[model samples]
Target: MIRCSAQTLVALFILTNITATICCPQTCSCQSTPNVNVDCDHRSLTAIPPGVQAQTAKLDLSYNKITTLLPEAFNSLSQLKYLHLKNNAISVISSGAFHGLTSLEKLYLNYNDVITLPENVFSSLTRLKYLYLNDNAISMISSKAFTGLSNLYELTISYNEITSLPASVFHNLQNLHRLEMYKNKISSLPVTIFQTLDKLYALDLGGNNLTTFPFGIFNGLNNLNVLMLMRNKISSVPIEALRSLPSLQHLHMFNNLLTNVSALKDLQNLKTLKLDGNCIQVLQDGVFERLTKLRILYLQRCCIETVFPSTFRGLSSLLNLYLNNNELKTLPATLFDDVQNLKRLYLRHNELTSLPSNIFTGLPLEDLELDHNKLRHPPVILSLNELHYLSLSHNDLEIIPTTFPIQRLRFGS
Candidate 1:
């Protein structure tokens, strides 16, 4: 070994530092110019870089071990639009951490260990639109937690340990469109939970512990479109719970314990109905007689063993029908005679082995699935004039007429 020169040793040290600084931290990215993105993740940073100023448009600080914010860390980010801090070990975000980020739009803080945040933590994010706080340990949120998010469009707080919500949690969010609070331990919804949200479209409250229904929860939701009530223990609803919603389009009540549906026939604007995975083995003769605009119907994986023709006659505009993965062995030949606009039909994984020759008479079926059944050949429909897609996989098929698909197979066998 020979002694190295001073200049040579210094140059070697500089190269080593450059290699260690190749990947940036997740909490903040510092680029030579704000036009480009800088990734500063997994660096275990304690504070945001001091040089941060209103230049970066997108700053990703996700998946870090940051526990505190210096407040001044975001004083320079006036143009920041997207800020992602998901999968981080951060437990605290200073109330002023977003003080200067007025132009911020989307904020992601999922997969963090945050238990709670200051009520006004987001008070300065006036232009913020979307907020994601799923997969976190947040137990309770202050009423003003969303104080300054006036223009927010979507707010997802799913998969958290939240037990309750403040009535004013969405107090001033007038333009709010979609709100998802599923997969939480929430036991109740504030009577005025959505009172001020006039433009709200979709609201998801699945996978909760609510036993009784939330009455008048949607009293003033004039623009409500979709309401999901799946995977809950709810057994019944208030008489006018859903009838009050006129703009409602899609209503999902699957996997609940609702045995009687006398309250559903009044949903005239309802387009799609998913009532699968429930104890609803019997549908009152005219249970769906009023859902005339229904386009898609899914009753799969439920306790329904038989259906009356009148049960589906209400869905005259239905296009797709899924009744597979059930215990039904057969359906009457006239079961679907009323659905003139039907196109796609899935009846696979059933106990059916055959169908009458006129089983699919005069139907506009383009996609028909009868696979995984005890069948040997295709349904004996004389012709599928508008048929295009057919799935018959994994069946006990043994023979097919040579005249079938006179031309070579084009899509599937």
Candidate 2:
């Protein structure tokens, strides 16, 4: 009788199991050294190739002509952690299409033709952290679409046609940190839409059609740091909506219709503020008195014609100030007295015909842009020891100062 050795028998059993579970489809490529990964992307196929290796941890099916995702299509890939399906024509998805992908952490569904998200479509992915759904034609999203994504961290739904969102759409995402919904057609939002997202840090709502906001809409987001509302139609900022955001550092509201910013008196910790491309014609005194830590301020192209002497009183830490493309005819001698730490100052394309000789005094300015203005004579910069680059081009100047030492200077007419 022929007797088999124990080692030979164990090897045979392992080979049998491997043969049953490790079969890469003919249209795809697989690797197993650094963990099983399947690449079936960019194929002209219309459906998912069957019999992918069960040990596959990452699968790429992006840039394909796949149109639909049937139920249980990826049930065999239980160990998958990353799935790339962006840039596909997938418009129809069965209810249980992503039913068994429990280990998936990152799912890319951007640049597709998906229009609606049925409820519980991603309920099985409890461990998902990153979800990308940008650049799609999505206009409707079920309120419970993200029901089981409790561990989700970052979500991107930008560049879509979504006009509105259900109030409880993000109620289950308690651990979410960053939520980007920019470049959409959203007109308004619920007052308490973000009440449950206490851990959120960055909220981007730029490039929308929002005309106003409800008061106290941001009360629960205590840990929020960055808020972007640029490129909207808002004419005023409500003080009550921003009173609760104590940790906010950057506020962007450029390219709007704002005429007043008196609501910014309480944001003491603000670092960067962009309010250009608006219609603010005057800067009142004590308007920004509370912004002691502000570093950069952009007020260009605002049709500004007047600025009080105390308009920049509390901005002691300001480094860069942009006042270009306005209608200012003259500036107060002490206009920059409070911003002694300023390094770069832009006052180009204004209506200033003359400047205060002591305007550039006591400043360590590195770059000063005064081009495209109506200045008849350059400002006295003999006290500016650290002046590096000075631009006085396209102005009405017939005589340029030669006493001050500058590395690069532009004084052409």
Most accurate candidate by lDDT: 2
Alpha carbon lDDT at 14, candidate 2:
61
Best by TM-score: 2
Count clashing residue pairs per candidate.
11, 0
**Cα lDDT tens digits for candidate 2, 1-413:** 11111211225446452222345778887776567788889888788887676678999999999889999889988899999999999998788898779899999999999898889999999999999999988899999999999999999999999999999999999999999999999999999889999999999999999998999789889999999999999998888889999899999999999999999889999999999999999999878989999999999999999999889999999999999999999999989989999999999999999998898799878788999998888789878776777888888987866765544454433
Whole-model lDDT per candidate: 0.77, 0.89
Q: Candidates' TM-scores?
A: 0.83, 0.93
Where does candidate 2 stray beyond 4 Å?
1-22, 407-413
RMSD of each: 7.5, 5.0
Q: Tens digits of per-residue lDDT for model 1 on 115-167?
A: 89668888889999999988888897998899888999999999989889889
